[model samples]
Target: MTRSPTQTGRRAFLAGGAALLATPALAQTTNYTTPFENSTVVERDPSEVVRRNISSFRSLDWRPYFSDTRNGAVLVDTTSRALHFWSGDQSVYKLYPTSVPLTEELTRLGRTEIVRKVVGPEWRPTPSMKERNPEWPDYVGPGPDNPLGTHALYLSWTYYRIHGTHDTRKIGRKSSNGCIGLYNEHIAELFGLTNVGTQVLLI
Candidate 1:
């Protein structure tokens, strides 16, 4: 099925990514105004930040990134702070703004696949996370305050996941510790689309 471009300037923005930022049509429609920067310091509270990252949200063909969309494919572009998904049959495609790792040291790249799916997922800070923030709670059950929001898709890599975040401001920013984060509604849609063994790649 052909996808309808309901939002004005979205087609142009997706077609060219950063290159289209200069166009007046897209500039007027887009809300990204923050300058992009690499920082070593973690954003403890992203909501307090006045500016957000100007992510290069773009649509991508899956062929170049994945050999095949076997059980479907998910590609997370750390530099662009965007995630791309394609169905196995090549009938569906989706692009979403994402929150990536805070720093280069925290980022992981390469191939991985979804091994599990969970609804109302619990949260546990990793050992390293705990070491860094000792005051953080050891565990958190699912709720509005939970870091991992409504749904989570577990990846083959340990302590890594493509999950939803309650914090909407984090999207389109370098706000995640390690995992790729999506808006709750977006993750809910993705959760229904993806299944176990769905191929994933982070770049």
Candidate 2:
């Protein structure tokens, strides 16, 4: 019987331990722009930021220890601010930079499954988020400035999402309020490939 990508990827994760791969420099370039491409609130170039941080972006083949039996899990590493998707093949995995909330709670760290996928997602700041920042809007319509970017992969666990960001500079950094953030373009591509019921492991 052929092993599923989930099975192989899970096995890798269990056996590989938590040692993450080194992020290599990215040589690719694109005409990237902030998610706020249409907004005039603040104009800034994102391609330049990407050029500066290019050295910190990377995607690696998931090691055997990072494998998943489901063959369709989205593995996230808070320490590295990186997310991986096992392509049902041990030799192939897609990687993207991400931002995870900075915390030290072991119980908060674990695996969950993707329960839904939202395109052009709206933003409703949580009570906790509002409390921390009183000026936060009650709701933000989907657009360039929306924190959820163009797509959001809603996790089974409440109050968390693998979504897009307006700030490209935050990628590969531990700078979220307890959610995973990806670049708008990156999340758009990821959303197309991901599906509901995909496993999400945050370690």
Candidate 3:
């Protein structure tokens, strides 16, 4: 049978659409590599992993979260998995992705101030962390292996910090024990901008 070119093209397009409709959608997978030495890589389905970047990552006003940007103000929005920083003079502002605590039980929400800032920060597993994972190292000096990365801002609350992570994958995920984690570069910049006595609020 002879068919017009237009008829042939229409048939071909319908066939392609049918093929696409028959194919199942592939689930997205992510490979997570732990920072610990000799740790095995694990593949996780999107649903299995902690939700990240789910909330709006837009710039926020400091007035809503802080009374004033005195000595600089840092606001960690656990729901959004983001960190917002406003300079003391309100000249410099930054927004960065962050990793929050693993679970609600580990999460602390309230006001705290930066009591100290350390470069090349050493790390020691908290007593509770040690009890939970005895296999973890007793101490890790400042280096690539150090989970605290290159810099750390110690908060007034004990065992809590706003620090950098050697594991980049941890950022924008709920992967920390009881701290907020940022990319090393972001933390270095933040470290330089902030100082002791910077007001921090985690909400």
Candidate 4:
């Protein structure tokens, strides 16, 4: 299929194999401890400045269990910090930890689907993010240091994503604005294994 210029550009950018896990120098210095404190002290690794903000990813109970859905489904258990990909078989699945919280507004429980998939996706800071950091760049080109990592599965929801992150340490916590964050390697694998329109269930 002939992709539009934007898609073509994205594909080309992704084809370059961007890193996706490096923090922008500006982001590295902003302190997340007091998000709205108006402090410009420039703390190191601000996004990952604190691990206690949410549950640790390592503490989650991850194991194979039965799901009646026999076709396929992407199961996200925020409470357990795990994302399970069920392969239409009750017995087969690949489990990865949930790296971000299900923000109340972004939660679309029940059923949804993957609307789109892109490799080396660009990073566009949300409005709230801009409010927090006015100095943030309007757009981050696709590359290794891009916040979206190496791949992204855009959900049916207006502003939700299952994508990779620059900071792996933020995994299994309430970090992202509302999207599901995954390690760069894990997302690359998931991106290869799934297709558009795959079922996604957040609970």
- Better-scoring candidate (TM-score), 3 or 4: 3
Residue range 4-51, candidate 2, lDDT tens digits: 999999888755432232232221223213223321121133222222
Return the top candidate by lDDT.
3
Per-candidate TM equals: 0.76, 0.67, 0.77, 0.63
As a TM-score, model 3 comes out at 0.77
How many backbone clashes does every candidate have? 0, 23, 0, 7
Report every candidate's CA lDDT: 0.76, 0.65, 0.79, 0.63
Tens digits of per-residue lDDT for model 1 on 106-200? 99999999999999998888999879877778888888878888999999999999998876666766787798988888899889989999999
- Model 1: residues >4 Å from true position, as ranges? 1-55
- Give the candidates in order of lDDT, highest first: 3, 1, 2, 4
Cα-based lDDT at residue 54, candidate 2: 40
Model 4 lowest lDDT segment of ten: 23-32
Q: Which has the higher lDDT value, candidate number 1 or candidate number 4?
A: 1
lDDT per residue for candidate 3 within 104-126, as digits (tens), equals 99899999999999999999988
Model 4, 1-203: lDDT tens digits are 88899999988766543323222110111112311122122223544333232232232222333345444577787766667775554344566765655366644556688899999797777797689678877888787667777889999887778998766655655666677878788788778767787788787
